[model samples]
Target: MKPFDYLSPGDPAEAVRSVARNPAAVFLGGGTNLVDHLKLGIVAPDLVVHVADLLPATVEDLDGGGLRIGAGVSNSALAADPRVRERFPVLSQALLSGASGQLRNMATTGGNPLQRTRCAYFQDVTTPCNKREPGSGCSALGGWTRHHAILGASEHCVAVHPSDLAVALAALDARVRVLGPDGERTVPFTDLHRLPADTPERDTVLEHGDLVTAIDLPALPPARRSAYRKVRDRASYAFALVSVAAAVEVRGGVITDARVAFGGAAHVPWRARRAERVLRGAPATEESYRAAADAELADARPLEGLDGGNAFKIPLLRRTLAATLRELVGEDAR
Candidate 1:
């Protein structure tokens, strides 16, 4: 690891100013992902601005409804919070379904969503990875892409994001609050993560010097009836081969509203807008679910051949989406 200076800012403004002044500085929230990146030589910074004291650790209730989760809040705390568990069960379920108990206690809400890809090529500094070093070219495309992207991926990169929380948050219509030297601004959770266009090196749309402050979730009634499902190589401590986060509102056996997002499928949390369009006003049945899943996946651009693993994703996505909707509707029926 490279030697670096550390600064523990007492406030968000100070932290932002410090990072803005030093372009090589990055905010140290939980140091979960940042630390790993540092060790892997993926990132080397001149200074680390610790922001634990600058942010709130508790979940605050939004006056109109919903919840304002502090960026500094631990994953375990967010998952176990009464408001998150009751109002947004999908978020809670997604958190619990990731990593392990120990790691959850250390991962922060902000860092959780901004996790780097687990693509072996990206981590192996000796290998060529667009995300790690732009213009080097992506090795995962022809090497091992079993867990690569199937949607919103460019020819430059096919690495999938590894965040269960982000998929649920996107489905729940959450917004990210960020603080920077310029001031504070709000960005939708979906907009925070970007598709790997030609510039595959930029993982997020966040400009340099921007620091995540908190995450705000709007009050949505259907979120109370939501759930998350993940299919992985192993039951524990494994990244999802495919995952689904879904919420459905059914009235008189007919779907009134629906939200769906998929993880381990794209560069960003893959929002199934096409599926939601097909689901609304449709009957809460297997046929309807199948149609919606297919409608959304029609745009899927899966890679081919032995290492691609994209072919398997097609069937897995359908099954996961279908099963998730079925489970949500079944619960509503009872």
Candidate 2:
């Protein structure tokens, strides 16, 4: 690992100011993914700014029944919070479906959204990785890419975002509060991440010195009866090969409302707007669910060449999404 200065700032503003002063400076929350990349020489920041003391560590309720999750809140704490468990079970389920208990204990809400992909080439410094080293070329384009992206991938990069929490947040229409050099701003959770486009090096839409302060989850009526489903290579301690976070409101044997997001299927937590369009006002049936899922995945461009093996993920994702929707109306007293 490279030598770097560690800054222990007690104020969030001061922490972001330090990042603004040094472009190579990065915030340290749980030291989960960032520390690993430092050891692997994948990232070489000149300074590490510890922001644990700068952010609140509790989950507070908003005036209108929404939830404001502190950026410093641990994944385990967020999942176990009674309010979260009762109101947004999908978020709790998504957190628990992720890495082991130990990692979740250390991972923080802010840090979870900043996780890098687990692509093999990106981890190895010897190989060419557009995300790790832009303009060097993308090794995954013609390499082992069973877990790569099928949506929003460009010629420069085919990597996927690996965060279960993000998928749930996307479905809930959460907003991320950020503190930067210019001051404070809020961005929609779905817009936090950017497409691979030409700048594959940049993972998120956040600019220099931006620090996530909290995540504001808006009041979602359908979220009360939502669910999260993950399919992976192993039973546990593995990333999702295909995952769905779904919220459905069925009334009079019709889907009155629906919100869905998919992980391990795109460069970001892909909000299924196309599917939601098809689901709203449609009959809550297996046929309706199938059509909705298909509409969303219609634009999926599976990679060609050696990495084309991930094409199967398209069908797998479709099935996973349909099955999750089925659980929503499976027990209706029709």
| TM-scores of all candidate predictions against the true structure | 0.97, 0.98
Cα error, residue 69 of model 2, in Å, equals 0.4
Q: Which lDDT tens digits does candidate 1 get at residues 85-184?
A: 8999999999999999999998999889998888888889999988888999988776777898889999899999999999999999999999877899
Clashes of 2: 0
Whole-model lDDT values for every prediction: 0.90, 0.91
lDDT score, residue 33, model 2? 93
Give the total clashing residue pairs for model 1: 0
| Global CA lDDT computed for model 2 | 0.91
> Candidate 1, which ten residues in sequence have the lowest lDDT sum?
302-311
lDDT of 1: 0.90
Off by over 4 Å in 1: 305-308, 331-334
Error of 2 at 279 (Å): 0.4
Tens digit per residue, CA lDDT, model 2, 95-156: 99999899999999998988998888889999998888878999987788889888889999
RMSD of 2: 1.1
